[model samples]
Structure formats: C-alpha cells, structure tokens
Target: MTGSPAPVPDRATRIVVVGAGFAGFETVRRLLRHQRRSTDRPIRVTLISPDDFMLYTPLLPDVAGGLLDARFVAIPLAESLPGAELIAGRVDSVDFDGRTLQVRNREGAAETVEWERLVLTPGSVTRLFDIPGLAEHARGLKTATEALYLRDQMLEQIELAARETDPAVARARRTFVVVGASYAGTELTAQLRALADEAARHRGTVPDDVRFVLLDMADRVMPEVGEKLGDRVLEVLRGRGIDVRLGTTIDRLTAEAAELSDGTTIATRTVTWAAGVTASPLIQELGLPTEKGRLIVGADLSVPGDPDVFAAGDAAAVPDLAQRSGKGADDAITPPTAQHAVRQGKVVARNVIASIGVGTRKDYKHNDLGLVVDLGPRFAVANPVGVHLSGYPAKLVTRAYHLLALPRGANRMAVSAAYLGDAVFPRPLVSFGLVSADEASFPRSQGIPAPDSD
Candidate 1:
C-alpha cells in the first residue's frame, strides 16, 4: 500500500499533513518510503484534505479541450498513497500553540484533531479583484469542476448559436473571452481556440469565424517565459486569429459583454478568469508570520520558532537560496511553480523526519530547470536548461515532460491513449452535464456571511 504496516505511534508523535496538492502529496510519499525503511519508531501519517484526488493541473487545458478524459488527470489518493491515512475535509483554522486543527467536511460537520507534527500545504485559491459582475460572470480554471463546466458551456453555447436565426445573436454566442496571460490563461485560450476551430466545421450555420479574445494587464503574454518566446507565442495566436490584447483588462463585466479599460466592449457569453492565485485562507488564520498571504518559513521549510510545524508550496513563502544573494532575502521568495513545489515537498519531508531525530535535514535549494508552454498539438515554447526551442521540437519536449512527470498508472495510459486517439478520430464533443460549481468555486469564503457594520 502507501506505507509499511508498522505499529501505530502514540498520539504525541502522530504526523498530520494538511493538503493533497503537489507539496503535501510529495511529503507524504517521501515519508512513506522513509517509514518503510526505518525501525526507529512507528511513523503514523495522516492526510487531511477536501478532495481524495490530487489533480495533475498541467493537463487541465487538454481536458477542457476534449483532448484528454477527466479521469486521466485525477490521481486517486487512497490507491496511490496507501501508507498514509486519508481524511477528506476542509481545514478551517489551526491553533499552532495547541497543535490542533479545526476541519469541516461536505456534510457540514466540524471536528478538531490534535497532532504532534503539522505540515501545512493548504495550496492556493484563485486571485480575484473588485471588478463589477466579474465574480458572477467569469468562470475559474483552478479545479477539475471548472474545466469540465467550461467544456459544457463552450459546447452548449456553440449548439445554441448554430440554431439561432438572428445573425447578431449567433455572433454574440460564438464569441468567447478569456482574461489572464499566465500559463493557465494562455494555454486555455490556445487549446479552446483549437477546439472551436474544429467545432465550427461540424455546424454549417454557425460562422467558421468564431471570435476568441485573450486579455491581460501584463505587457506581454506569458511573461514567465522569455520575451522571444512570448513574442513568438503572440505571433502564433495572432496568426491563428485570436485577438491578443496586452496591458488591458476588464473594467466592467456584464452578462452580455465585457467593457475594456480602453473604451471598447466585446459581446460574448463565455468568460474564463485565470488571472492569478493566492495562498489558501487557512494559512492566514494560523497567526503565523506571513509575506503577502504566504506563511514565512526558514530554509529548512520549518515555521520560524515552531520546531513542530512545517510549511511548503504556494501556502508558504520559502526563501530561494539560489537567488543572487546567498542569504535568504526578502525579495527571494521561491516562485510558486510546480517544479519548486515538488522539490520543496521532498525537502519538507526530510526536515520533518529530522525533527523527529530520524535523520539530518538540509536546506531547500535548487536552480530552475526551465519552462514549457504547450501552445497546441504542433506548437510549443520551451527553455530547457537555458536552451530555447519552439515549434515541433518544443511540442515533443513538452509532451514528453508531462508524460514523465505524471504519476504512472492507468491514468497515464488513458492520457496517452486520448492524445493518440485524437489523431485517429474526431475529438469527442459530448458534454455530459455531470460537474457543477455551486459550492466549489471559492473555497475559503463559501457559506460565510459578511460582517455587519458597527
């Protein structure tokens, strides 16, 4: 299973992990391996999270575009992590001094659990602003539910547009707008544009010239990548007829259209918001030192002055030791990328073990390998170890990296089959209305009422 069937530890040494994203998952995984090899003590590990699956977020755009099935990206926690105990619940708050966590589940039940060692990897939530009607009108792409819902919405809009006799109504329904030029927004825009291209061919009445717009407040698309690659990506999107607007954003969003800051408006029914993400709200409730909503931890990934507590991933502002300044500087917080999170997770596990006197701990340090952006099946931009590549070779490297990085199992096979099958057959357009977003959208503030003015 996930861990060795050793004797259970007493309540005092119980290890409780607080998330199931890349950081927490890797922490538990490394703990299991070390526990199996050690005879020092019974390492009782427990994981508490809202969902039982660790979503492989990189392939979410492909899933939304019908290039891959939803099941392929959802790695089952119970099956993959048998060594650790799983508790499906949402953490409300943490009492650092008391070493207790208040958690609530889907059934509206709340409970408190005490632990000896606490690992906080609560991850992050979508970053939203105070724009009017933006929350109600725009959809997020952080979770699987959002991805699936967007797919259905896209299909339903196209279907409804094809039947509309009014030309103006049809055009409005065919138009789609996406805000955010980060990897998530850019990939979503690129993949969905590919889907829309093929979708138009099936319906004769719907104009083949369906409009797709990409907007961002940044100066260029995917500023995370090099300017050369960003320019190339911008050129590619423009060549494919995607209206790429930079240094612009939505001033006001209505159900019918989005008003841009430049006194322009676009009529559309679909709006996907992928602008940014912030640390999970649960982190702030802990009363720990924080930098911009992220828990501040030492190079060892342990909370300052709290030897029993550790934090990592997007939830923690871990210092980047590989930065220009050798000392941990205020401006050298590690970037919230999957690569850093994965490596940080492993380091947290080792440090936690060392906290229990099992082994020695090392400082969290690593240089970035590179970045890869999947523009589409044949187009990609990548900088692997300072070497930049684009087009077919970049696409190949991008796909290979994902395949190698994804956890091995039936899910990997399913993902591979879906990619191969897309070339042999028409991509599936069926939209089974199975996923919903009524309660899952913004997790931390859900069901909580605003405070009354004194």
Candidate 2:
C-alpha cells in the first residue's frame, strides 16, 4: 500500500514594497508593468505605506506658499498603481529572516505579510539635533500636510497681525525665520518671502516691512547647486530684502522668537526647520550596517548578506560610482536627493525583476544631472546640464522640468494651470484655521493628534 503525500497549495511570488515616496512608488509601478506583460506565472505586488497618496515633494513649497493647491501635488496611490494591492498602514517591524512584516493601520489594527522579495524605501524624516526648543517650536516641510499647515500658519499670523495695533506684536507676527540654506530651506524661504510680499500688499504693511531671515551653517547658500548658481540665488534673495545669514545656526527657539548662534535674536512668530533629514528609525531597528543612519546597500541595490532584500532613496547609503576611484572604492556615497532617488528606484525595480528570473540585474550608476531652485515667478536659478540660466528663462525651464517630472498627467495639468493663474491673478490671502500646535511642530508623529481627527 502506498501513502499519498499532502498536496501543496499554489502561491504566487509576492513582492512587497514599503514607503510610497519616490523610490517605493517607482519600484511598485515598474514591477507591476513587467508583471502585466508576463504570461508565464502569476506575480503579486503589494505596497505598504501610512499614506494613500504619493506626495510630489518638489512642488510642496508652492503649496505651502499658496501658489498651487494641495490636491495638485498629491497623487492617489490606488489610482496610480491600478493592479497592485495597497496596504494602508505603517510598518511596525520587519522580520527579514522570516520574510515577513508587521504593519499597523491608523486605527491601531495590526497585520502580518509574507513576501518572497522586499523593497525598503522608507524615506528620511526631519533631522533633529540636540538644539534646545527646536523640536517644540519649528515645523518641517516633508509632507503635504506639513506644507498646508505652514501655509495656514503664515496666513493666520498675517491676519492676526492686521488686527493688532501694537508695533512689537505686529512685528513679531510679520517676522518669519527659516533655518537651513539647502534646497528645502532656501526654496521655502524664497517662496514664503514672495507670499508674504504679495499678502502684505493687501494689508497695511508694505512688502519691505515684512521680515524674513534665512540661516544656514554653510558659508554659502545652496553650495550643492554650484558656486555660480549659489551666488545668483544669494543675490536674488538679498535683492528681495531677505536677511540671508551664512555660517550660522539657531542657538535656541522660543514660541515668539529664535536665538541665533551669532548672539543675535530675531523676534518672529514662525520658525521652519528644514535644517536636514535623518533616516527613519525603522531602518535602525533592523540592526543592519548603516552609514550616518542610512542602510548600506551594494552596487545592485541589494542589502549585504540578504539577497532578497533591497533598499534605495534616502534610507539607503548607496555608493556613488562617479565619485569613487574604482569598483572597490566605497568612500564616496550618493547624496540623498530626489534626483538620485528616482533613478535608484528604476534600478532597484530592474534588479528585483531579474532576481525572479525575468531579466538580468544591472548595477546602478548615474551622474548628477544638475540642480534647479525655483524662487517663484520671474525668479529662479538653474544649472541644467552644466549650463547656467537665471531669472525669467530659468523660471520657464524650471516649470517645464517639473511638468515633465510629475508622475501623473492630471497633476501636471493642475500645476500648469496654477502657474498660469498665479501669473495672471494674485493668490488669496486667507487661512483655513486647520493647523494646530501639534500639527505644526517637529517630531510630530509620536503623540500629536492626527490632522483629520483634530
């Protein structure tokens, strides 16, 4: 007599991606595209993230300054990735050895997912240092909610100032302080100043009276962009009456003002901390090798000693092939910028497909394409393909580039219409009164109230 063995259930190869930023979104999209054309076997693709939309971070400043609507920049993930399973939750912990993940939804319900391949693109969060009172007072520019909160805060301050007759209180309401002169800080500073200037025209105070201070620890503003472009940006900002403080840091932050390391204190009601970003704590929990908080990955974007795991974007410390001496030289690392993240996402997708025997894996190698800083209409600085362009022409190039880079056609059209409308008509100077103290602070996720609940 022969005994029958148990029948094994059929299962599709499951691919799970975490964090729906530029990197994770791209990876899922590419894999689904590949799976769509394949006729051999079934492949399952799932994206797990806290938010249901993929934010277009480049245009966030515009939304904060009321140049573009918030809806224009946030693309619905479900619609964007039609065929993939979208898990609306934050990953609590990952079991790499078991190929499983523990995720918790907004309602505190938890679930576990098992996958054949895993991609980690949990983007970095606002970098908080040991500075006193910073986490309590300053706001970040990472998400659409933060940007909208900032916009409402700015407008509310202006409106409150309009009702006050006291010179000191009015001045405090009109003043705005932003730290970090890099891409986010610099761009936000410029846009906010423009917003204040326009709104001031409709109020009692003149544009020149509105105070804006842009501070940075680096000697020159936007040094990463290029020396020439930095100088031009500095000039434009200065010409707009923005107090650009180079080689400075915030000594202390208060509800009413910011104390600079240079012993100068600026009285202001608004403080924005775009200083920098650090990798999310989720990466550290994995106990993987990391450089400056970013998980280390190889040339193929695969995590060391874990062939099935891969990482990219701000969460991964990818070696810069262009900056390195040769194959083994791992001294230089690629910057955690949107440009690199987008390309890394593509490479990781290709390699992930190759891992499942669909194609061949390729190493990630890309040169810096250049940088563009939009300082509102008729004012921008760009070094596209190593050619310097500034002022109006630069603005046009910058807008065109954004339109091309935006993920959705609807978003691109909305942004374009907003740009045109901005040129023709003035933006409304009003606040929605939606932002609260908890929603407008650094390190907000831990105990702060959710935006919708509040």
> Which ranges in model 1 have alpha carbons more than 4 Å from their true place?
1-12, 204-208, 326-330, 437-440, 443-454
The Cα RMSD of model 1 versus the native structure comes to 2.8
Candidate lDDT (C-alpha), each: 0.83, 0.85
Clashes of 1: 3
For model 1, how does the per-residue alpha-carbon lDDT over 36-125 read when each residue is reduced to its tens digit? 787665577889988878888888898788788878999898888877878878888888778888888878799898888999998887
- Report the lDDT of model 1 for residue 181: 89
TM-scores for the candidates: 0.94, 0.94
Best model number under lDDT: 2
What is the per-residue lDDT of model 2 for residues 1-454, given as tens digits with 9 covering 90 to 100?
Answer: 0112122225657888989999998998898887777756557888898888888898989988889888999888878887788888888789978889998888889999998999999988888777878878888888877888888888888888888899899889988888999988988988888788888777757887778899999999988778888998999899999999998989998888899999998888889888888887789888889999999999899998988899999999998987685554658888988899999999999998888888898888888788878997588888888888999888988999999999999999999998989989888676787768676565454222233342
* Each candidate structure's count of clashing pairs: 3, 0
